[model samples]
Target: MTLLAFLLGLALGIGFWLWQRQRLQRQLKQMLGVLQTDASSTAMSVVSRLRQEIAQANEHRSQLEERLQTWRRLLEVAPLGYLQVDEENRLLCCNDQARHLLQIDRWEPRQLRLLLELVRSYELDQLIEQTRHQQKPTIQEWVFHPPCLDGEAMGEVRSLTLRASSWPLPHGHVGVFLENRQPLIELAQSRNQWFSDLAHELRTPLTSIRLVAEALQGRLENPARRWVEQLLHETNRLINLIQNWLELSNLEKNPSKSLTYQSLELRSLIQSAWQTLEPLAQQKQMCLAYVGPDTLWIRADEARLTQVFLNLFDNSIKHSHRQGTIRVEVTAREAQVLDSEGTVDSPPFSNASDQPDSDASPSLIQIDMIDTGSGFADSDLPHVFKRLYRGDPSRQKSQGTSEPFTLVGSSGSGLGLSIIQQIIQAHGGTVQARNHPETGGAWLQIKLPDHKNLS
Candidate 1:
């Protein structure tokens, strides 16, 4: 019986060991399944994140493309000519206006062609080169003669005056803007021609009228004689007006023409000009204070320069209060000196003469004429030098009292300053008008190159 019990116990122990092994296998399978599920979830999360990034990248690229297209459209329709060039001076892009201005044939938008080959403009190329090298904006103006095609007349050169401004861009590129100034210039020339023709037509009629007035002046008496004298005065004023118009037309037509330049004393010229208007000055008891060298010299056309001073003096005398002083000051200095009151580099009516001949001189003569009169009306300063620009009638009437005795030349023709400015410009000089800061009077300043300084 003891032997049987031992065998049964051993069998029970083996059964227990088999049951534990089955339980451990079940636990291992459960752990493996859990690990596999976690790995799958991690992989799906990574894939989702990568897809979102790709989509965002595509959207950003699309936005960039849209912006680029918008810019292209705007540039294509711009009125001003626009051109873009690459580092190699190859034409990268241009607007229709640019193509028309350059007279270039149509080409593919992306095509790379040398700019010189298409336009053949040295000035444009030089402007671009300058901008690239200096990395700064540059402006240039030149008259371009378009290349003649076959069957075109050799003399039929199409000339265009163009102004171009260029600036550097990223990647060694340059951008240029072009403007055609031919139309505006032609319009100005047309207006000038019309005026000149009108002036010519009026001259003969004016001369005949003046002769008639003179004849009538002698054959009248008493109040009628006074009327005849007034008529003569009005007629003579008209004649002078016509003469001045013709003279101005001639000057505008060719500023440098018929110039007879000579060295003469400026102070003496001023005194001489003053002498012609002495009777008018004396009528008002106006004091003339000439504060300049008695023998300052300038190279100029004596007659024209005398007219300049006469006009200025007359203007001052007409505007000065009775017993008020008109002071004339003259000084010589280097070209670099800046006139604190006014610089004659730019005048009110028109562009001044080009800088005096580079080889000529480096000295400038400055003249200041100040009148202790009602200063230029603040509103009238800009228009003072424009042809036929009259000041306020009230102001003119008030100033008219200064020279009550001289009736004929008392009032301004409104052409005095304009003519004076032109005469000074013809001498390679400039003139400016302003109110004296200290004196509260009319101030006129002139600058002329000193010929004695020439090397």
Candidate 2:
């Protein structure tokens, strides 16, 4: 019985050990399955994140392309010509208007070439170079002569005026906007010519009427004579207006053509003008106080300059208060100096100490004429030199109902200031009108380029 019990115990022990070993093996297999599932989930997550990032990147690229195309479309249809060039001065892109203005017949999108090779425009090239070098904006206007092509006549020169405004871009690139100004210029010239022709045609009829009126002046009596006298006065005024308009037309056609320049003592010339207008000045009880070097000289057309002075003095006399003074100050300066200062550069009413140093300058002469009265109406200041611009009725006060300042009266032509401007400009000089800060009245300043002495 003892031996049987021992063998049974050993068998049971061996079975128990085998059962434990199988259980451990099953646990190990389950752990490995769990690990593999976790690894696969992590890998799938990584791939999905990468794909989403790629899609976002593509959307951003499309947006950028859309914006670029939109800008290109807008620029293509713009009225002004737009041109772009790269750092190497190569033509990058241009609109149709640009191509037309520059006369560029060939353009290839895939190829880039120097601007000079496509369009031979020195002015355009220079403007681009200047903007690039300065790294800023620049402007230039020039007449462009397109190259004569295959069968065009060389003698029949064709030209157009072009105004270019350039702006610098990143990396030494430049963009230029071109405007063709020839059409506007031609239109203005045509209008001026039409008016000039009308003025010419009216002259003959006006003269005949004037002759008839003068003949009837002696035969009429009392109130009838007075009516004829008024008619004659109006007729004379019309004739004067016609003559002035014709003269202005001629001056505008070619500003320098009629000028006969000669060096004349400025003081004597001004004195002579004052003498001629002395009667008018005395009538208004106004006097001119000339202050400058007695021997100062200038090269100008004596007759035209006299007209300018006469018109200016006449206007001053008409606007000035009774017993008021018109002060004339002369100074010599470099052209640059005149370019900076204005007509009313002096102190209020002036002081001897504040006078400009009159030491002679080589390039220019400045004349300032200031009157003592109410200055220009604020509304009338800018239009003072414009054609047919009239002053406000309040400012155009006259002596004894003569209405001296009016071009012809409430029905005036208002060409006096315009004539003065043309005469000055024709002599290569500039004139500015302003209310004088010193005298508190109308001020006229003139700057003439010196031509030196000539025989």
Candidate 3:
């Protein structure tokens, strides 16, 4: 009986062990399957993300390329010559106009090359350097002489006067614009020549008519005598106009020929100019008042400056109220000139002998001539100095209240102020016309540089 129970127990134990081993193997196989599935899902997710990233990168690159193409197309059609340089003055891009203007043929856009190697212009290089240093827009004009082709001197050297404007850009880059001004200059020269020729042709006929009118004035009486006198006056006025035209033409043709500069006192010159027009001023009961140093000396052409003052005084006297006053003020001081390409005249100090050393400083002489008369019309102010410009009826009258001064010699040729401006500009001076704030009259201001400081 004991042996039978032991055998049954051993059998049961073996059966139980076999069942546990089978269960363990099944669990291991199930876990391994789950691990394989998770690994496959993670790898697919990574591949999808990489594809999306590549597509986005391609889209961004396409947009950038499109923008670059658009810019290039726009530049191709631009009329003005356009040029771009990198930080080191390397030519990065240029348009057709630029290539033609610079006479460059062996360059392509986007190819990096030194600007100096292609275009041999010192002025252009200097302009670029200046613009970069100042970080401001700069304008410069220079003549370009093309070199001979094929290293031979057989070709004609064409000279082009070019005006260039440059400005700074990002990353130390620069942009330049070019203009050709030779056409306008030539047109102006041709027009001046025609006008000078016409003025010369009219001189003899005008003189002959003046003589005939003078002869008829002695043979007429009363109303007829008055008519002859009027005709004589008109003829004489025409003759004066012709003479003035000729004189102005000569001055414009050769400014240096008309100028004979000398040191003269400002006060004395004013006094002398006023004397020439005293007869007209007295006729209108006008007075002259000067407020300045007793003597201010400046280097100037005495005769031309006297003419300037005389014209100004006459205009003032004609427009002055009867018994009204015209005031002249002169002042001098130092000022920083923004543009130093021109010369100027300066006033003298209080002491007659105290002359300024122009080499030591830049000085300006300001002359303000104000009148108590009808001010310039707003519409007429800009054209006051233009040749042959006559104002409208409202501007022609005195403050819209009375007739213009019609004295025999009072009617001007409408060229006086134009001539004044020309003379002053030739002397390296500037003139401005405005209505005085306090006096409510025409204000003419003249600014001249000190001659000693002129280069």
Candidate 3 residue-wise lDDT, 1-455, digit = tens:
79989998888989998899999999999999999999999999999999999999999999999999998888878877889898999998888888888888878877899999999999999999999988999999988876666656546556778899898999899999987766776787788778768878887887888788788888878999998888888888877777776777777778766888888788899999998989989998888988766666788889999988988888888776778788887765556543354423343213323434433333677788888777676777878887667666554535443333221123367777778887888787888888777766778888877775333
Write down the worst ten-residue block by lDDT for model 2: 402-411
Q: Which candidate ranks first by lDDT, i.e. highest?
A: 2
Model 1 earns a TM-score of: 0.70
Candidate 2 Cα misplacement greater than 4 A, ranges = 1-50, 87-89, 106-141, 149-152, 334-361, 394-412, 453-455
The number of the candidate with the highest TM-score is: 2
lDDT of 1 at 101: 88
Off by over 4 Å in 3: 1-67, 102-161, 222-230, 283-285, 320-324, 333-364, 393-411, 452-455
lDDT tens digits, residues 297-361, model 2?
67889999998888888777776778888888776555455433333233334343443353454
lDDT of each residue in 7-36, candidate 1, tens digit only: 898889999999999999999999999999
Candidate 3 steric clashes:
3
Candidate RMSDs in Å, in order, are 7.2, 5.8, 6.0
Give the worst 10-residue stretch by lDDT in candidate 3: 401-410
Model 2 clash pairs?
349-438
